[model samples]
Every structure is written in structure tokens, then in C-alpha cells.
Target: MIINPELDKLYNVRAAIPNHTDIFADWEQRSVEFSQNVKGQLDLRYGKGPREKLDLYLASEKNAPLHVFIHGGYWQAMDKSQSNFLGKTFLDAGINVAMIGYDLCPDVTLRELVEEIRRAFVWLWNHAEEYGYDQGKVQISGHSAGGHLVCMLLATNWLSYGLPTDVNPIHSAIAISGLFDLTQLVPTSINAKLGLELEEAKLLSPLFVDPQNICPLLLVVGSDESSGFHQQSDNLSVGWGENFEQLDRMNAVNCHHLSVVALLAEKQSSLFQWAIRHLGS
Candidate 1:
């Protein structure tokens, strides 16, 4: 194995330490408060059973595209409330946005979390008219773990769930800093708490799965992210080939893992503009 000291340092920060809860407390607090002010119906029910709530943020205008955002906390941390700030930009662009929350790992298996996301999409599809969405214009975007979920949604077979065979809930996807290959993470400390085995890792990996029905996808990473992250993005784009239609891999200059999200708010950024254009088309 080739070892680059600088690359190793980037991947080994204190935040990379396993099960570090307090590292993101401040940002989480800010996101919760920001979500509260967006003004929309909250925790609308999808499943009849417990733990089936989803927060909705409707656009002020009618017939808007619905953007569903999933927050990233390595599948063990963060909440929907902490990602409320994300809806504002889409809302401003006359698009509705939904920030979904799911049960975290250890408390719930990764398989369960994936089911929750799938249910969330089902709910969105069933209630698209109520939320002023076109249903056909829905898009999925997420960061890190959220990114992985979005890709999974893209790969899901709608026919198996009784939905229209050609209907993909996600018209396009913007996956930022996603972990497409879970096998590489199996040896990491985080895998212990996640309880991920080699077989499960391959099964859950978006990279390993056949990319048969993907929409236009944008794979983004921070210019300053670790080599592992950079590699993951490259691998997914290359693996998908034609299925990864209109691929745009961006390197947000001078940005790091956390700060790179700011580019989403900057309407001028190529990534942000590309997303808007895709949704508009």
C-alpha cells in the first residue's frame, strides 16, 4: 500500500475518531433552530406504525419540484431538524424541499434505515399533490451517508414496490462526499458500531450494484477532502459509465468536508447551477 503522510492526516482527524458525538453538537443545534423557522407542516405521517414521521417544507409557489434532502452523520448522528437550513435555497428557487430523518445505526440496523428512506419516498409520492410537487419532478440530494441513501433510492426497483415500473422518484441526484464502497470501510473503527460484515457491506454498496436505471447524477467532493473521498467519487463515476448520465465531478476549491456545503447556497457555483438547470429541464 502506498502511504502518503498528508493524505493519512486528512483522514485521521479527531472527527474521524469512532463514535464522536459531541464533535458536531454546535452545528446540529444551529440546524435545528434554522429548520424551525422555515414555516410548513411538520412530521406528516407516512407509516401507520411508530417512528414513521417526516418533516415537510413546501414551496410558496404551486407546481414546484420537490427536493428531498437527507442529512449525513455517518448513519449514527444528526437529525432532520439539523438540516433545515438546506431547504431555504430550494424554496427560494420555487422548489419544495423535504429533509428526512431516520433511526440511526446500532439503535437500528443499516438495513432498517434504508427501509425508512424508501418509505419516506413512498410517502412523498403518495402526497405529492398535497405538497405542491409534480411527483414526476422529484429530485434526491444528500451528503455523505445521505448521499449513499440517495444513490440507493436511484437504484431501487419501483416495480417491486408496486409503483410504476418506469417511474424513478428521483429525476436527478446530487451526491456529495458519499461513501459508495462500504467494503473499504469494513476495516475502519466506525464499522464496529455499525456492525457491518463483508457480505453486508458489498450488498449495501452502491458502487457494487449494477447502475441500470440511474438519472443524471452529479458526484461532488471538496477540493481539500481526503484521498479516500476523492477516490470514492472517481470510482462511482467510472463504474456507472453510461448510467451516470451527465456526470459532473466538482472540486470545490479551498473547501473541506463541512464547509463545502456552503457551495450549495451560492447560486453562482457550478454545482448549484447545474442542479437548478437539471431540475428546470
Candidate 2:
């Protein structure tokens, strides 16, 4: 696929951030340290696939709410290991945290990633009791590509997955620095491995899909990110308006794509406070 230079500039997050490498290194170092000390289970298999596993950290309180986080790598990069640092604040707040991992693109299609995530959630719901978390009090959050997955999960028909419609498993969701419209990525270099054609992109786009059940949804983007990202969040906020039981939006000040995820680590940030409030609601 031929890449569009302008579109590439708009969506290529690493190139946009001068200190992306440093940020990645910090995330890795912090995540590794966090994983070593946190009271949790690592690499818990949720499915038969090699990457269909999650790292779970339980709260001190019994039967606490579960806050599942999905890492973002444009659906082609990163994994659960780099995301463990995101669990600490929630864990300290007496909310159980789970960082999910899924197979990357080229090895697996975007559609497959969505399916695997749904399967992961089903596993979590089924085993919530054994893991000491309340299944009914589940909230989800994701960054970038993971944000796209969160929206996809919201659009999923729980009834088809053998879940009752009256009480959906997801109580609320937060998509930080999310890519909602896959169609915009098709011409860019980001879609090389994703191989998303126009029709498939539309089919996979969260903006085009209606939510299967009503749930509180929050859309967040970094103030310094490219217009493409801000548009993505704004478009979804408008497109999914009727589907969300409640909707909220935030622009993390002085932040870009990578730095926004760091706000979740900070206990006092508005992003953190807003997320915790909705998760508890």
C-alpha cells in the first residue's frame, strides 16, 4: 500500500513526539518494577492463543470493582508487559486491575483481535468470583489502539455471547487517545500491517457501529496531539451519542498521545480523577 505523507504525519504518533523513545523506556522500566512488587498474577491465560493472556492485580478490598485496561500500539505494537504500571493507582484505590494482551497485526487480523478481546472479557466475567472481583462492577479503559478496542467491545452484542441483555457486563468505559475511524488509517503507513481496506475499515470502525447496550462512555485526547486524533474522539462522541447512557469528553492539558497515558499513573490528574469517578459510578 502506498502511504500518504500528510496522512502519515497526522497518524504517526512516534514521529510526532521527540521523546517517544524515552517515554517507552520509562514505561517499560516502571511496568517491570510495578509487576515485581504488585500483589497480582502475571500472564494468566484467557484463551488458547499465545498472546491471549492478561496480568491481574487484585485490590485489598474483597470483591472490588474491576478496571480492565487495554494497551495501545495502533493494533500492531506493544503488549501487557509495558502496561502494568497503569494498574497501581487503581489497585491503591481498592479496584482490581487487569492488563490484557492480544496478538498483533500481520500475525492476526484486526477482526481477530476484537474477537480475542471479547473472549478475554468473557473469561474475566466467568472467573470473576474465583479471582475475587465483582463481575457486575466491571469498567474498561484503553489507550490509542486499545481505545478502539474498548469501543468495539461496547458495540458487541452481549446476547450473542451468551450474556443477558438486561445487565451488561460493562458499567463504564474510557478511551484515551483513541482511533475511532479506521478508514482514515487506510492510506497511511500505520495500516501496512493492519491491511485494512476501505470496506473492512468501515465495518471495523467504532464510529459506524451502534452500541449494543447503554453504558457510560468517556472520550479523551491529549491537547497536543494531531488534529486527526482530536477529530477521532470528537467524531465518536457525536456518533455514539445516543448509544451512551452518559457521555463525557476531556482534553488533557499540555499532553500528546504518549504523555496522556501517564496521566492515569498520576493520582491527582484530572484524567485520573475523572476515570476513577466513572469507574465507581
TM-score of each: 0.88, 0.98
Question: lDDT by residue for model 2 over 58-177, one digit each (tens)?
Answer: 987889999999999998899889988988988888889998999999899999999999998988888898989988889999999999999999999988888877788998899999
The local distance difference test score of model 1 is 0.77
Residue 269, candidate 2: Cα error in Å is 1.0
Candidate 1 per-residue lDDT, tens place, 1-281, comes to 33345544544434554443453565566666666676877877766535557788887788788888888877887677776776777778888888787878888888888888888888888888766788888888888888888888877887766677766667888888888988777766657568888899988989998764567888888887788888888998888866765777888888667666656766778877877888983
Q: Which stretches of candidate 1 lie over 4 Å from their true place?
A: 1-33, 48-51
Candidate 2 residue runs with Cα over 4 Å from true position: none
lDDT of each: 0.77, 0.90
Worst 10 residues of 2 by lDDT: 272-281
Q: Over all chains combined, what TM-score does candidate 2 have?
A: 0.98
Worst 10 residues of 1 by lDDT: 11-20
